[model samples]
Target: MFSYRHAFHAGNHADVLKHTILVHVLDYFNRKDAPYWVIDTHAGAGIYDLRSEWATKRGEFADGLDRLLAAQAMPDAIERYLQAVQHFNPDGVANFYPGSPWLALQAMRGRDRLRLFEMHPTEIEVLRDNLKREAAGTQRQVAVYQADGFNGLKSQLPPAPRRGIVLIDPSYEDKRDYRHTVQALSEGLKRFATGCFIVWYPLVQRREVADLQRALTRLATPWLHATLSVSKPAATGLGLHGSGMFVVNPPWTLHDALATTLPWLKATLAQDDRANFTLARHGD
Candidate 1:
């Protein structure tokens, strides 16, 4: 489906979880001297205006970044993610929200490379324009492609530096996207078994999501799976209840940091008794 525009939901709860994990992953990569690549398979427009008509109509950020921005005394991991967001808003306002590509670029070093894929025509153009403006015409640091990330990511595996992170999170507007995500990861692991992998998924009422989780667990690797549910399933099964991030080959420090951070997120963002959190790990 070409209808999925991330701008409408930018900075929503899913983004809070996805970007938290993404920042942690990128931070870990920066700790090493060897350069690492960040491959974002579903890079949306690098930036989103919260005041825009599209975002104003839904107001998803009101419950997501807005809540986080109001809180204080966050755990270091959570604080770090928000600090990265702060870079875009030096004027001390929340009129804009950084998408995944923007957050990734902010955290990545000049030596590190970025390969972004966005199949949507409008998003690709916006993605390029945003990078150009943000990079101040020095966008060679990142490469943006208007292509299917699933197939396009194949050649990037086992990157020259032999260290990197592959972030795969499609809109899942098409059922086949679920299968495609798993297949891409499986193939990627074969080529770069030690590289970090992060997958973001919505907590929707769907069997394909369940199947995707079950299939991911079948991969024999050290992993961490964390989720935050801000509300019970919608009565009509129509909205995103929450979201999750499944990480493979995660940093040792990451699992522990999130263990402390998830509870605070659940409490601060809860909608009802249905709000809850989970942090599970294997082969640690």
Candidate 2:
């Protein structure tokens, strides 16, 4: 839906889980120095200002990044994420936040490249400008596309370097996106079976969420699934309670690192008594 502008929800709890895990996966790829590509489907504006009118209207960051800023003794993984956030907000003020593409760039080596696809036309414009100015020029480090990521991302498979990460995070404003999400991965795996794929999903009172998870399991690839629930679902049975990341071909060290840090996140980001986390995995 065109109405789903990410500007309003920029640094919410969902972004926290998504980007934190994103850094972990990207860092693992960086270790080999082989030069891989980071593909971001549904890439939003490259950066967001938490103090903007849209962000102020939602006030989501107060319950998201703000909670973690003052945290002491965070696990190493989470600490690294905050350090990256600090890179953008150098004044010791938590006003700016990085979207996935920006986070990938931060953790990438000189040879690493990024392919970003966004369907929202306006967001695509901002995304293009951001890459041109902040992320370097086109045909250089970044490529931005104004198209449905589900369909557009396929052309980027088995990237030039033969190593890559595909990040799929649709607005889910359309339920069809759930089916398309799995379809994109299925098609992508046929071309690059070993490529890392990360799917970010919201925790809501909806059946599609579970169905999507089931479809992912049927892919039968080695994977890790982690979710953070910050509070009980609302009595009205609406809105997001948390978010999760399903990593296919995840880093071997990721599960252990999350095992150490998720509990900390659940507790630190919790909004009420029902806060918690769930972690499951197979084929390390």
TM-score against native, each model: 0.98, 0.97
Instruction: Give the range where candidate 2 is weakest over 10 consecutive residues by summed lDDT.
Output: 130-139
Cα deviation at 239, candidate 1, in Å, is: 0.5
Residue pairs in steric clash, candidate 1?
Answer: none
lDDT of 2: 0.89
Decoy 1 TM-score against native: 0.98
Q: Per-residue CA lDDT of candidate 1, range 82-135, in tens?
A: 988888889989788888778778877777888999999988998888887776
Query: How well is each residue in 1-284 modelled by candidate 2, as lDDT tens digits?
Result: 79888889988899989989998888889889799999999998989988899999989999998888878779999999898888988898988899998898888877889898988878899888777777664457777788888998889988988999999999898999889999998999898999999999888888999999899877778999999999999999899999889999999999999999899999899999999998999786
